[model samples]
Target: MTKTTTRPLAELQADFVRVGALLKQAREDVETLRRLSMAEAQAETLAAELEAIKRQMDRAFADEDKAKEDAFIAGIKDVRITEGDQRDNLIRRTFTVAVTRTGNDGLRDWETTAEKTGLTSLKPEEYAWLLRHPDRIPASILALADDPRTAFQTYFSSKKRGYFRGA
Candidate 1:
């Protein structure tokens, strides 16, 4: 046997109001979660777009630098201009691996000597490291650090902002 129960009209209405409030809160929570998910998706998309823009910027800068270097070299090689500065050109200091250009056996000799001396050949990272730790380096090896070579570095300048150049 089961007992039956009944509530007064006012009580039932109160119950309905409480249940309705709970339902409403649950609906709001779901909506909030959906919005958060959408925002995350948007953020991910934006990050990817930003990365793509960075890659494009890097490529554009590299292409421009190469073009500038090519033009500078060609001008010199073709004797169109001697070593001098032009309108966007400035004399820039640079370093190269201390190796001789003394004909066919020169490169081989350098490699052998470098290996025998336990000296890693000057690569980009090695060169940067050398520059960074100048204090730790000895004078003999340091003297091999060639005089700053002159390069026709290209650049632009404007009154509004200032100078701009590729690395």
Candidate 2:
């Protein structure tokens, strides 16, 4: 023999509602997890792409810098050759002048200094470049002058005592 049990209709209806609510919540949780996983994957892909772009940009910048440096070196070499030729061709002249300075004993002393002429004939740019790069000036040009700066200043004042032509 078998026995069958039945609950009240109102209680059975309440239990059905509770079970349906639990199933809906579980489905929503599963959908939320699926969306989260997809977002994480997309983020990883985007990050890899960003890293590749950064590397490419760095290489491009390095190439640009190398090109600029090469051009600058070539230009400087050309200028050096041209200026050296000009300096070599000049007709240099020399004269003597008295330079007075305070001695260690707090007394003024005078000394004869040999100065070069004809540097005033050089173009301004040529003179400026020679001034900036003293080593590039020919040894003959620097021989009598005190220094590159003083040698280049001859261009500004040719009337200075020892600088007169045929003097």
User: Residue 99: error of model 2 in Å?
Assistant: 42
User: Number of backbone collisions per candidate, in order?
Assistant: 0, 0
Q: Residue 113 CA error for candidate 1 (Å)?
A: 32
Candidate 2 — which pairs collide?
none
TM-score of each: 0.29, 0.28
Residues 36-119 of candidate 2 have per-residue lDDT tens digits of 879988999999999999999999999997676554432232123212234322343332212122223357543332333344
lDDT of 1 by residue, 85-111 (tens): 234322231122332222235455322
Alpha-carbon RMSD to native, per candidate: 15.9, 18.5
Top of the candidates by TM-score: 1
Q: Number of the top candidate by lDDT?
A: 2
> Compared to the true structure, candidate 1 yields what TM-score?
0.29
